[model samples]
Target: MASSSKCAFLVFLCVIVLLAPSEVHAKSMAKAQGGWYLVEGLCSKFPDCNKHCKEQGFLGGQCLKLGVNMLCFCIHT
Candidate 1:
């Protein structure tokens, strides 16, 4: 009887271990994603601006001009 109980307990533990990864993955998928961080700097075209931002380890970037120089809002993930 004791051996049977131990076997049952081991099976339960194995099942839990098998199910745990899926639960963690599901939770992570369900959780809200992070927001974008804006990095302000001088820029020219949108492509060049975005490329520079990505090169700087950001997610992407966009150029918006306030005056003479187009301000590059580098998107940092």
Candidate 2:
């Protein structure tokens, strides 16, 4: 019984570890010169980012993929 419990615990741990990272991730632009930061968000197309970017008051926005997910990048001055 103790061995079975251990196995179950290990399986649970494995699932958590394996699926910990998501396919899509949102991130800010790195080292954007002139105070430009890359904004990241989940998206499926270019327009999807426009609203989000406008809300943030960014100069513009664009959609990009970091892994398996589409992210919207809002560019601000």
Candidate 3:
């Protein structure tokens, strides 16, 4: 019974190892599909970021709070 449990654990570990690379690759692929750019200034509000991105000819923009800094990311197709 103990040997069977150990075998099951090993199988589970192997499955995780096999799936890890594909997951990482998928994330990278998604990032490559629609590019993201860091805007020049801090994002005080999402609407302002969106407007800025539109003016810059991007599809849209989002304001992300990283620590104390509010950063804007412009998205394009």
Per lDDT, the best of the predicted structures is 2
**How many backbone clashes are present in model 2?**
1
Query: Which digits, one per residue and each the tens of the lDDT, describe model 3 over residues 1-77?
Result: 99999999999999998766433311111243558554434565445887888887878777766455666667766
Kindly list the per-residue Cα lDDT of model 1 for residues 13-59, writing each as its tens digit: 99998766433311111111365646344453345877887887877
> Model 2 over residues 1-77: C-alpha lDDT tens digits?
99999999999999887665453354646556566657565675445687777777787777767565566777777
The number of the candidate with the highest TM-score is 2
Instruction: TM-score for candidate 3, please give it.
Output: 0.45
RMSD of each: 15.9, 4.0, 10.4
Q: Which of the two, 1 or 2, has more lDDT?
A: 2
For model 2, the stretches where C-alpha displacement exceeds 4 angstroms are 1-18, 23-29, 32-35, 44-47
| Candidate 3 residue pairs in backbone clash | none
Deviation (Å) of 73 in candidate 3: 1.2
Judged by whole-model lDDT over C-alpha atoms, candidate 3 comes out at 0.63
Q: Give each model a TM-score.
A: 0.41, 0.53, 0.45
